[model samples]
Target: MSQKRVLITGAAGFLGSHLCDKFVSEGYFVIGMDNFITGDSKNIAHLTGNSNFRFIEHDVTNYINIEGDLDYILHFASPASPIDYLKIPIQTLKVGSLGTHNCLGLARSKGARMLIASTSEVYGDPLVHPQTEDYYGNVNTIGPRGVYDEAKRFQEAITMAYHRFHGLETRIVRIFNTYGPRMRLNDGRVIPAFMGQALRGEDLTVFGDGSQTRSFCYVSDQVDGIYKLLLSDYTNPINIGNPHEISIKDFAEEIIQLTGTDQKVIYQDLPIDDPMQRQPDITRAKDILGWEPKVGRAEGMKKTFEYFKSLTEEELYKSEHKDFTNYHK
Candidate 1:
């Protein structure tokens, strides 16, 4: 059988790079695209010499023209982290809106299936615990984090519109807080933030009294769920995350234990519109895709700690101080 050609946007990102590796290893011809706004080439550097992999530097918001009979398109391009989208708000909106639309068009033209990477941010600061896909989110459209939340909401809306109106084959995965190797150390997401600080022997910053809770999905499990969703016949959005929940304070303490650092947990004011709790109701995913996270938090954190430890002292220092420089100024 001929290998399917899979094009993944934001292919240099944490999740994107993992997807690229998964697809290529499964014998798919993988083409990765990224503008490096939040993604870096170094994330996908390991695949540079692979015969089954190719890389393209392009923004998904721009016209994405590709040749050949593309088998699948994984639209993972977006400024995902708070620091990233907050710094480039308009770009975040554009990638979610324009970028998704462009990918759908490409899918339609090539007669290929497409899976869009949506986020749990679409849930906003939820009024419900263990958020299910059926729950309508309580999103603040004009809040500081609205750019990312509403952008993803709009991405889902337009994607469904394409599926219904244009008969385009589409799949949407609502990704939860995922972490592992290749995560950008300065992305301002909680795991990397805690790990980077601990590596440098700095105080771990926990926002909002550290009471907020979240479920962290390991990257490999996330990639598996996404791949299954893309190949499945389901067209509606499905939540893909570990259902286990942990408080921010507990998470920080765990990292402290894992890294064996003397760093203490410090409380900072929570950012505006930060979700107090986020745990995905993955019943739909489990029933439909037969997938759930296999790695527990402790094991996942151990693997992640080893990855961070492999970085040079200078790299770890830069990651730790990068976010603080602007705050001090």
Candidate 2:
């Protein structure tokens, strides 16, 4: 059989870089694309000389032009973290809408299968426990978090519309809280923020009385599930995440122990529209793709902590928020 070529947007980001590695190792020509707005070059630096990989530095919000026959497109080009989306809300909306459109157009033109990176945020502050695909989320469209939540929701709607009206081969994965190597230390997410604090010997911050819960899937397991969903016959959305849940307060304790730190946990006001509970119902993934997370939280957290510990003192002390003024379309 001939080799397959896949284009992965957001290829320099945490999950995107891992996906690029997976495709290349599977013997496919991988085209890695990113605008570097939130993605770091170091994430994909290792793939520079690989014959199976090529990098394109471009924003997906504009028209995308690929030179050859493409077999698949994974639309993962969005500012995924709270600090990122909040800082660049307009860009986030544009990427989810315009970026997704360009990718869909490219996929249809090339007769390539397409997969979009949706998020558990689509179920925004869900009323249901252990959110399933069928649950319609309770989201505040005008709230601070709405930029990202609505973007993904609109992303899902457009993807499904294309699938039904145009008969396009489309897949969507509702990714939950994922943590692992390459996660920005200063990103406002709980994992990186907590770990960064621990590494620097600062008190871990817990928002909203620390009762809010999150389920974090290791990056490797998340990539595996996405890979399976992309190749499966099912065209509908599937939740890819670890259903293992933990409250923020408890999770803070876990991190303190893991880092062997002497810092204590400090409570803070929760950000507006932050989800009180976040967990995925992976029943569909299990039945359809035969996929489920294998890495336990302890094992995964340890591995991730080690990665953060290896960072230089400069990286550990970088500002709490990234400066995005230099990024342009």
Candidate 3:
């Protein structure tokens, strides 16, 4: 039997890279696409010599040209982290809207099953607790963070259109807070910020009153959920994340204990439009995909810390303070 062919955009990113590894390990011909905008080459470097894995340096927002048939297309492009998106707002919006459109067009042309990566941010500062797919999100469209949140919302909208009108095999996974290896030390995400501080013997910074809550899903669990969803028959958006929720302050303390660092917690002004609470109601995922996170926070954090510990001292100290040109195409 011939191997299945999968095309994964943003294949050099944290989640995208992991998806590539998963598909390749499962005996699929995985084609990785990336522009290195916010992704690091080192993430997919391990598969450089693999026969089944191929790399393409291309931006999805631009015209996408891929030869041969694609059985599956996992549209994982776009700047995911807050810091990265804020720095490259235009590109972030373009990838989510234009890039998703291009991927959908490609999938339609190739008669492939397509999956798009949506986010918890779509539920922006959500009013509902343990957000369900039915809840209409509370979002400020003009807010700074709106660039990302709205982009993802648009991506989901167009994907549904394609599924309904073109009858394309499509799936959307609204990912919640996920963490594991390959997370950059200075990505400006709470986990990386706290972990970097702990690993460097610095005080961990907590934004806001620290009462804001988030549910974290380990990468392996997240990937498994996505895999199940891709093969499932669902067309509407589904939440795929760990239902385990924790506050920012409490999570920070957990990081301190996990890293064995004596650093005290420090407070910082909360960024505008930061979500107060984020927890996915995975009832749909459980019933539909039969998926739930298996990795506990303690175990996941330990593995993540070890990965960050292996990085060079320079990478450890490099500031991720976003310093990029504004709104460039």
Candidate 4:
């Protein structure tokens, strides 16, 4: 059989870099593409000389052109975090709408199955406890956070349209809170924010009363599940995340213990539209792909913590988060 070739958008970002690593390790010729608005080159720099990998500096919202056969496409390009999407709301919308459209067109022309990464944020402070695939979601289209939540929702709608109307092969994975190496320390996510403060011996910031909950899947487990979903026959969305849930306040306490820092948790006002509860049902992933998270929070956090501790003093102290809206305007 000929070697399989794959295109991974956002290939330099956290999850995208990991995905490139997975495919290359599996002997696939991987094309790693990223616009780098929020992605760091350091994340994928190690693959620089690897024969099986090629890096493309381009945004998916614009036209995409590749030279040869592409067996699959993982359209992971988007401003994922609140810090990112809030800073570039227009870019976020374009990537979700225009970028997704470009990728679907490429997939159609190449006869390649495509997978667009969706998020549990679609569940938007969900009325359901542990979200399942059928739950539509509770979202505010006008809220500041809506740019991201609605984009993914719209992304899902278009994906299903492609599948039903055009006979295109498609897969969707509703990613939950994920953490590990390469997560930005100042990107305004719970895990990295807490870890960065702990590393610097500062108080861990807990938004809201800390009762807001999140389910974090280790990077390995998440990547493995995505790999399975792409190859599987299931075209609908599947939730891939650890079922283990932790309250934000309690998670702050866990970090205190993990880092053994003298700092204590401090409360702050909740961000607008933060989810009160989040945990994936994952019944479909369990039954269909036979996949469940193998790494516990403690074990995964250990690996993640060590990575943060290894960051340079400059990176650890980098307080400013870049905003590209001015440039885009």
Identify the leading candidate in terms of lDDT.
2
Please write out the lDDT profile of model 2 over residues 1-329, one tens digit for every residue: 89999999999999999999999999999999998888999999999999999999999988999999999999999999998999888989999999999999999999999999999999988899989999999999999999999999999999999999999999999999998999998788889999999998899999889999999999999999999999999998999999999999999999998988999998988889899999999999999999999999999999999899999999899885777775433
* Model 4 Cα lDDT, one tens digit per residue, 213-258: 8999999999999999999999989999999998998899999999
Deviation of model 3 at 141, angstroms: 0.3
Superposition TM-score, candidate 2 onto the true structure: 0.98
* Residue 283 shift from truth in candidate 4, angstroms: 0.7
Candidate 3 regions off by >4 Å? Answer: 321-323
Weakest 10 consecutive residues of candidate 4 by summed lDDT = 320-329
Clashes of each: 0, 0, 0, 0
Give the lDDT ranking, best first.
2, 4, 3, 1
The stretch of ten residues in a row with the least summed lDDT in candidate 2 is: 320-329
Q: How far off is residue 242 in model 2, in Å?
A: 0.4
CA lDDT of each candidate?
0.89, 0.94, 0.92, 0.93
Tell me the tens digit of each residue's lDDT in model 1 across 1-329: 88889999999988999999999989999999998777778899989889999899998888999978899999999878888778777888988999998999999999999898899999999999989999889999999999999999999999999999999999999999999998878678999889888887789999989999999999989999998999899999999999999999998988898988888889989999999999999999999999989999889889999999999877776642223223111
> Model 2's lDDT to the true fold?
0.94
